[model samples]
Target chain A: MVQINFAKREINCKLVYYGPGLSGKTTNLEVVHKKAPASKKGELTSIATEGDRTLFFDYMPLELGKVGGMNTKFQLYTVPGQVYYNATRKLVLQGADGVVFVADSQPDKMDENLESFQNLEENLREQGLDPKTIPMVLQWNKRDLPNVLTPEELDAKMNKYGAPTFEAVAVTGDGVFPTLKKLAQIVLEKLNREYGLQNDGPGGGSAPAKEPPKEKEPAKAPAAATPPPKKPAAEPPPAKEPVREPAKAKAQDDRAERERAERERERERERAEREREREKDRERDREKEARPKPRDFNVTPPAQEPAKKGGGKGVLLLLLLIAVIGGAVGAGFAGKLGPLQKHYDDHLRQHLGGGTPAGQ
Target chain B: MAMKPSDTDQKLRKQRLIFYEDDIGRINKALENYQNLSKSRCNMLIDVEGHPVTQVGSTEGINLETIAALVAASFAATKEVAKILGETEFSSLTHQGKNESIQLSIVGDRTILTTIFDSQDTTVGMVMFYTKELVEKLNAIFNEIKSRKDSGKPIFNDDFKDMSGVLDDMFGDV
Candidate 1:
């Protein structure tokens, strides 16, 4: 999921494009990269195998500019779409914020499409994400293909989950931006629902009135958003004459500048302190590097010389003491910890980390 | 009154992971070389198979059996509070003894901030308060490490394995 930082006014999220091999998953990403301005897209990484188009995965970080005054970014990724790459695909799906399933719409790729959907379900299950609940949209790609399955048939099969579906010819960028925009908007809506980010949308949408948090206000107030039922405007206190603050506003501006300068000074002070700390850290590290080294720590040098001399008389007694006393101490500590341990075991038995009653 | 944790907090309980065993060790080593901790011991960062991911500390050769139990308890108690208040992660867990104590704080979903203390030297409350701040710093370190790992940027060696879920349904309901 995405999190919006209100104070910094930025939204961070991860969006992954998933599908089977040769489905234009990478093609979709490449199209976005080529179209987006250089400043908006990060360098793309593609790992292609000798025989396959995509070997591992491709990752591109795209800055989706700012939405509602918060900087928006989407890190788009494509899993290597081979049957054998399920392990890597599962890893990449570990923390998906939003998913775009780019299915090849060509008639011959129908079986591949179905298999990929199953794989997606299995991966989502492994990651504990309910496919029904994860923010997702489906994109049927290669729509321009004459032999491609009709949208109705494809939706009936693949988009049966009722996720928002889009048709795209990713090669020529048809329906690409619209798909991205829709998914991005869905991602933002989910973020809003999750984090209460009630900011207006990108097109200057009016802010929705916030529902007051259910706190300790009593029954005297009606629950509706209506104004107070009665107004107590009977007070007759005369209004004070309008105060002219133009002269004072100048002083206020000066104070504001002073505050800004003070903040800058404080920042500089902090930087200097950090530099000093770094220097000291370096000096201390150098000293540690140059310091005299201690002799053997864990090694006992095969217990030679003086140890053998003492072994004749005292060694037997020492060994006996160690064995008997050590055993008793260990047992006592174990017993003391047993009650708490049992309580934990009971809980573990109930939870059954190894999964039972249907978990695989 | 306690602050209400959001549902987003619950995600941290389930899906959050903060891993930095190597970075933590390097930090602890610098502290040890500087004699910051009197015991020259590092508390458990990740309670792995037999030993804690530790570099310095008096908990040398501590049995993993107890720590594993403790980690489970810590998560259970936190989960209870989290589920009740809609929070996902916990601030910290502290246990006091006659002359020692151990504090566990959530640094990241994956990583924990642990502090071992002596009653003769430090108060439990003091350790709790300070460890909270320390865990905040560790949280940043965890985030940095995670982002670096995610971006395919190479850093210090990272050893993350596909471990099973930390808790399960068979575990008693909190």
Candidate 2:
């Protein structure tokens, strides 16, 4: 989850490092903490056992000085990669906006890498996110070790999502910053798309100018409508010799015209009222759909929420049925409606039951 | 490349705490009042994920960012311990030291309140009482923030090309 604090003009994003035991997940963070400028980094906090293995997690926060007028900060965390600490791993992965999977490249650690990858996918699914769609990067750490798996082999075996991959020796800071920078770029891109943020050029601090004009356009429409009648009334009177009958006729014409304009305005007001009611109904529906569902927190594992998919298929099927009906009527096949209706019903049932529909 | 609308919509549904100017003002005011009444050394607010929200008091020697992270993790670990003991949770945790002590209490569903005070300056009873009262006030403020309709707008533009340069400047020297 991204925290945008308008009060302080700050934006915070969480990024997590995940991998198997002894995979240098912590080493990557340690290297970055050491190399990053003192002004831009915080103290590295680690909760480790007596043997120096991480017991809980290691965290370091980095400050990326003002980006587009907001103080952007990234909180980097490394989950304990030991197998039994999966509960802690799930906790750390809770609100992660992006993930960096640091895979140990040694050939002997292949099984561990695969297991950890599966675990990552399972945890992400439990959080109601698609593993394939989330912003992610892969780092093949321990590249300096002899007899390590080649990048080609690792990509073929463990790069299931085709995420950007880096070869790094985290102990020496090789390829570490590049991996982090790539992850940040993709994460920012995702944020920009989600929030509909426009690029106002480099270092520009101007507020979004698109939304205000859209709102003003609707308000101006009514104001513009009221002024047209006033303009006609303000025009100069005809400069000619006055005849009583012609002047009386002109007065009657003006009265009838005024009544017609008044009736038009009344109809427009009714239409506007109806539009507002429809908008309110739509808003209510949206709120109901968006309301979060309550969950029992005591359960050892996080509750799984069903993935939302197949929404567009229903609308597509409805359109296809309408098109088929129109074509049938054009061919003068109205008498054959019974068979067509039966076929459509069968197709709909098959599609809903997870079977391929006949036509498609 | 363009993203799918459904994907963007799913991303938008994630739980996020957006603090507007008014929301931060109220939170800071509440924290200040708690400090005055409790007479503690200092206090801080952090989310369940260990991100610092705000802090108030004499935080001269303390590393607040580090403390916030540790406190959040400890609170979570304690929650697990509570489950093992057949309880819903232990809402408040206290660590008593020889000269200084700390108190952590869950303010609302999403945030925790932590206060550090010298053992000699205040008793556990006083700190606990003040903590309870402060938690109630903080909870109301959080509820109001959550119900606000116009939280705020995104501050960043789409161009992220400059980020690589910024990272280089910070890390390249080292």
Candidate 3:
């Protein structure tokens, strides 16, 4: 489905590249990503495995500045080509506005191409899309290789609805852009026919009517567009007004219905954005709560070592040890001095005469 | 000759979505509620075809474009798993991780809601609960969009004068 952003004056559409394994679906995207101007292309992202096989898909958003009157952007995607990846392929096919089926051109690969085409049809059916109606382009890739089925042969087998087909050597960038241009043209035409929309620009309502066959020749472009312009002057009203009048009324009704629905969605987006802002504020508050605080010192003492500083208790212990040793040495020296011994004996006899007589 | 059921149904089906100014607000509200409730790192509203419609939240380091594509692929694969197991389909799928996880569920039939969250900050239970509620809200909105009647007039009956120029500029002489 195409999304129109009136606020940005932009239109976004999805286009997928699908094929059997190694059929150059990814190569087509690689060429476009390589050749598209830097300004016109977004980053090319590939979600592949170690062997470089696309596991999920490849994505690139190309900006076509402005078409009709709005900024038109095309998102290109490629599904994994393996048959076992059918689930993934169906997923990528969902809501696709357009598709490009890149077929392997080798003669032996014909069966694979047919199988892939059937797969595409079945997948489109599951998504409620008709392969007959969806704007799809066929690319006969690896055209530069040998023993490949010719474009006509491949088209007969795979393009049952006669979608625009292209012959390409995707690795060399040949036919890639032409195929894309054709697809975009058809997609836009489909949008215009179904939704009353043309890319936003000059000749907005006047251009598509002049080239009706262009839609059929989506496979051959740059050349397909060479047809002479039709009654450009008389065609404006009959071409634009009559079609637009009934469409405008219906468009307005559609717009009303769409508006009602989009309004609710818009409100949800705003509410979510506001909630995100508030959540960020709450996260900041939590961080503040977890921060260190000076008040914590009141609960537990500050971490400084008093023992390592060697203060009052250490000095008192050293002084006590020195006094005990000095007393013991002095007693031994007094015993060895005779004069000092006689004085000591006189004092002993006076104080303890009864104890001395018992000793004698 | 009898036409197939799809051929007849195609005439009445609308293939595109049209938005007015007010619709943006409602979409935001639903997405905002989900992000808040889940505390997700990011949220993306994508069509089943892997196109991103709108996104919100902390999308840093996330390549939303790639995420949108892969989410659809993985979800589709999971649906196949359910079919193989004899079930109709899985309602939702969550890919858990040590630090981050992603939850994917359909909003209506055409859209998918993808949410990426951090397990360290929020629980999977919170993400699943809010995601389910958000899907219901979004489903209501998408149903309306899907039901819109389209005007059958050709949008650009005008010649594709600009298309050639675009192609030329994008792929010069290719």
Candidate with top lDDT is 2
Per-model TM-score versus the true fold: 0.43, 0.66, 0.65
Model 3 chain A poorest 10 in a row by lDDT: A228-237
Model-by-model lDDT, in order? 0.53, 0.69, 0.68
- In the range A1-360, model 1's lDDT, one tens digit per residue, is 343322223345667889989988998888878877787776676667776487656777677664433456676778778899776676566567778898999888989999998999988877667676566778888988887887778888887566766678899977565556555655554443332221222433222211112111111222232111111112211223121144764675587458546644654575476567556656655664564332321123244434544546455445544654575567555544443455446436745865331111
Better of 1 and 2 by TM-score: 2
Better of 1 and 2 by lDDT: 2
Worst lDDT run of 10 residues, candidate 2 chain B, spans B150-159
DockQ of 3: 0.20
Interface RMSD, in order shown: 24.0, 22.4, 17.7
lDDT of 2 by residue, A218-265 (tens): 111222211111001111112231212446646855874575466446
**Mind giving the per-residue lDDT tens digits that candidate 3 earns over A270-357?**
5576567556656655664574443332222233234324567555445544544465456445433433345446546855885531
Please state the error at residue A219 of candidate 2 in Å: 55
Give the fraction of reference interface contacts each candidate recovers: 0.00, 0.29, 0.30
lDDT of 1 by residue, B1-174 (tens): 112224443452234332333454444543343222222123556421111333334444554323533453355446556667987656677777776676766656655556666554435654554454456555676566656632211111111010001101111111
Model 2 C-alpha lDDT per residue in residues B117-161, reported as the tens digit of each score = 876455676788667878988899988876766322334532343
Lowest lDDT 10-mer window, candidate 3 chain B?
Answer: B1-10
lDDT agreement of model 1 with the native: 0.53
Candidate 1: where is the Cα deviation over 4 Å?
A: A3-7, A197-360, B1-107, B110-174
